[model samples]
Target: MPNSAAAMSKTGMVTKIHTRIRADPFSAHYELVGKELGRGKFAVVKKCIEKATGKQYAAKFQRKRRKGADCRMDILNEIAVLELAKANPYVVALHEVYETSTEIILVLECAAGGEIFDQCVADNDEAFTEKDVMRLARQILSGVAFLHRNNVVHLDLKPQNILLTSARPLGDIRIVDFGLSRRMDSITEVREILGTPEYVAPEILNYEPISTATDMWSIGVLTYVMLTGESPFLGDDKQVTFLNISQVNVDYSPDTFDGISSLAVDFIKSLLVKNPRKRATAEECLSHPWLNPHPHPHPHRHARSASSLDEPETSQSESEPDSPVPSPDLDDLIGSYLTCPGQGELKAGRDAFSFGEPPFPARPEIQQEVIC
Candidate 1:
């Protein structure tokens, strides 16, 4: 039965022979080759090629079961969001999906440029100019707007999830990873604390109702990291980081904003507000002067010179713990941040995985009822 093919009743149609059938359905169409692009707790993304067309793709091979039961719903939800937002230029495309008895393979668009965080770190000398940030931010907002229009909320919007099409100067970006995404009605509330500790919104930490504004808050954090290499709410430890986010303890000191433009600062301020209702919507962000500055012959001048700003120094004693902290132990902290009174801690032992070239970070699950 595993390799059998069913025939449909035909009134006046001819059946073709050579109908492909294989014990492993994935191998029948695509050939997985080359080194693994990335790895996670339950999945490995490898480079794959279409047998017929020789087209390349990043195939994410995920196990159907995590502990015992099938955990395919998360993957299915991700697929749904991708299908809804496929037309958006900034969102990564899901080409095809193949499932076997034990695994599900998702063929995704090959992002050659890699993660935006890596690009930002690598380009320390030739830092991104204001125009570059503006263009990238605009494209990201366009993607967010499209997702919002489709009633999709990308709860986890971080630099690691943003990829470039190419390594060229200011190449177009593609937003990947929907592990924490959810589809909801505009008026309904999503109540789950499921996002990276540093970039997650305060509303999420407080276990308050969530909406598209949650994504907007993360966008603000992304903007901060994009402009300044340092994380705005990063604390000495994970718990401290969560407290910083809950308290909205953002450091917009002169040191951090020394060379940054006031308009750009205003744009970030608009999104990072503690009150989710007060945050700027993605559509509104597109019109912000920071993103749509007056055109000038020397547009680069609008962004303060990167050379004038001193890189913020971090002492190991400030961030790292005296003793090594186990990676899995952080799950407890995440559970504390995510769990509310009625909702128990989200099922643990689930590896937070992304669909990038290499697995970046495991995303936390947020439980919410879908309105549609």
Candidate 2:
């Protein structure tokens, strides 16, 4: 797979990335330093240390061919997105890429902070306060603002995809997992029906055009979940979740928003709008009164701490999280659709639907979920 450039089928679109897939065994350069991080249908993320610098990184192995389809171009689309994020301060850095005959492994800077999902699920009193969430929201908005400024939308922005620089003292957030990211432009529209169901926007379900505003919707969900340790749109199953999102069904009851500030609710309201155009921009979110009430975190204040990196982590980047579906088929359909799917995301937004047989086709029961 030495820089194959098979043109996209109908659009004749060529990837912007010069993905020089190195034909080297990943171990020849990097040493596996920790336990395997996570696994999915076609990908697995593991903690590895660069032999040259002893710097720890997450090595993600993805199949070159998923099912019967050649996915080299789709992967290139993801690489192009990462290249854009590489220039941003709050994103994980993609350091190296190695390819075996069957699999390609992307080496990325390791974020030891684990996932924000961990904090959201924590029952401890100190896990988060309104102020803590505001700070985290600001950080997320900042990174998202940068990406949006560059005309990219991170289609997946759940808590599981956001990582902390450190777990203790609840460090500054670093946006990871760009696998589902897409570049937006005034001339062309990107549409796809693949995302973790809970955070997906209405436009995606409708197969409508995607924009930076799409990322804003997920931010709204993330903020809501962070403020109250509950999912706003999740239901008994995927269909229920999709229906809730399609109809803009969200819980704002006194019980759900107990002790939460009205400004915070307003902030979520501004973002969770059914129409993408009505949703607030990342920059607007940063200026919202909810986040402004507290002095937003200064960039230098949240530097990565060595103590945090030394701690063992249980975070898994590739596994489907928060899907209430009992069928493993749906789980794979949700998470494995993207590469790595780490907090440092690597999802594809190409016309991969044209590929021969989906990499991991859902059982007939869940196939409708994919087309939705």
Candidate 3:
């Protein structure tokens, strides 16, 4: 059966491939609505509405090339990681995919709330309340736990990649972006030295073996960023940033991190251990005192309301509430990033249809997993 946007919440917590969907690629059954969310070097994400169900989604479109490039492979790898992560609630959900002559489209669930980075960058002294941080941290750990169990390592874990569906009464938090993800089954260690320099683990730059622990280091960075509104490591150049990480020369002044709880700081210290072997696992992170939700109440704040962030210019009625719904235009989603294809040798007849069923091969163990 085709899953509607209304059914997303239930699906978000379980893994089940939509086998009923087949080759109706590029059909216009759905209506594109709302504003474009964001764009990358090779793809664009637009907030959209499914005409059939009146549901909102973020549609990512990657132009198809006769021959694939590193950018295209990165997108494919992201799809693979999302497939492995589907059983977790803390991970974004993949809805549908379509193909046009020029692009491959992926429909995704849009977290109604914006990026966590938006919150972090709002003010220098701004940071999530301890309760809010713990809620988000727990969600993040759940997603990471699911990824590690599937033998997939998310190389890039940061505030920008962490998204929220609802942040009021403190809303649902989820992790996004899998461009740097890799599977452990094929290669035991990663030496590629990829990922944002500031949040990368020390061993990554030293060309040492990369393990699940590497991601834990990034989680530590995330924890710090959530509490302090600043990244732990920063340098004018990549080389300098890497050098600082190797020496473990991070400076954490009490004045610089005012209002941050000691328990939170201690939790970060345990995970940010210079040695990978000493870093906490995702499961261990859940057990940290900082993440204990029982002692803390969910946050209540005076900041701007979520609906006020960027409400559609035109309002829709409640009876036909979706009547005046806005469309997330393709142009808005892509923004100025859409460029002419780069010159490269073209592979003839490389059939885009050959990708098989949408999402390709599904993991057998997905059925038993629970979204964090």
Candidate 4:
């Protein structure tokens, strides 16, 4: 079963609902062995070891309210989605859940590898090759297809939201943060101005109807970032970036695609079509020639001594929630940002997670998708 986190219905509805969760304190069964792995506006991810098995996991503590706003249902929405996709492997799994006076903790599988954003910016020898990209693309599409099939759209798909099970020699991807996700339905037409600027679909900016094609626009941007290490539509600022995307002003210069395949370029072209109807679906993307299962030298890098950026004191990982004893209050830890290396860098930080901005806030849902 695939899994995800955030507050929303699988059918694309953003409404409040009750969740079945353990109301006991999270510290009763799991010990906070290390530090907070990551944090955002309304949540913090911490490293916890289940007392029962000593198996490690990442516990996300999401605030029930933001700035004195009651939003407990937001947390429940995420749990609901994770619960819905429990069987899909590509999406991260929610091992367990717990509730407290102020927060809900989601125990998840700690991903040993970090966010693919690292690989996108990785240098020289560690750079991802076509084969590596293909492998990742398939996994991403498989997960997306799973979500789409369920009528859910991860409206904010980006490299930071895509995590790897293992970084070295690369491994399967685990899609995270469904706060912005919505379920698509034949009966309802979803429309909203949401998502990270660079990865956002044009229709969103134009205030047009939203659909699965919205996510496809992001996949195109993500693919370009993976192949070229540069954001195709990133402009001087948010407005310029919006302009670039609105006009489909992508740069497919020789320098950008120098060593890349023409098929890869064509794949991106197909997805970046200004018209959402013209963009490829997740299943179609899986069948694109660029992703054809062709043999090539393994591009997954071997493990090496990590640099400072590769290691952080408290990286986010997957874990299930359980409490074994009295735990420290998270007043300081919960809101403070983590430089977790084991889990990955807190990709966006507070600015990214602020309900105010939309590079889709740095998240512990650290999220970009909370459309509330």
Largest lDDT belongs to which candidate?
4
Q: Which wins on TM-score, candidate 1 or candidate 4?
A: 4
Supply candidate 4's per-residue lDDT for 230. Answer: 83
lDDT of 2 by residue, 177-276 (tens): 6655666667776666555667878887676777889889999988888888788887665566667888899888888888899999999999999988
Candidate 3 segments whose C-alpha is farther than 4 A from its true place: 1-27, 66-73, 124-126, 293-372
Ranking by TM-score: 4, 2, 1, 3
lDDT of 1: 0.61
Clashing pairs in 3: 33-327, 33-328, 34-326, 34-327, 34-328, 88-371, 89-371, 166-171, 167-171, 317-321
When superposed on Cα atoms, how far off is each prediction in RMSD?
A: 13.2, 8.4, 13.3, 9.5
Q: What is the lDDT of residue 12 in candidate 4?
A: 58
Q: What are the clash counts of all predictions, listed in order?
A: 2, 11, 10, 44
Model 3: lDDT of residue 41:
38
Which regions of candidate 4 deviate over 4 angstroms? 1-11, 14-19, 293-372
- Quote each prediction's TM-score: 0.73, 0.78, 0.70, 0.78
The TM-score obtained by model 2 is 0.78
lDDT of 1 at 159: 70
Q: What lDDT, from 0 to 1, does candidate 3 have?
A: 0.56
Ranking by lDDT: 4, 2, 1, 3
- Judged by lDDT relative to the true structure, which candidate is superior, 3 or 4? 4
What are the lDDT figures for the candidates, one per model?
0.61, 0.64, 0.56, 0.66
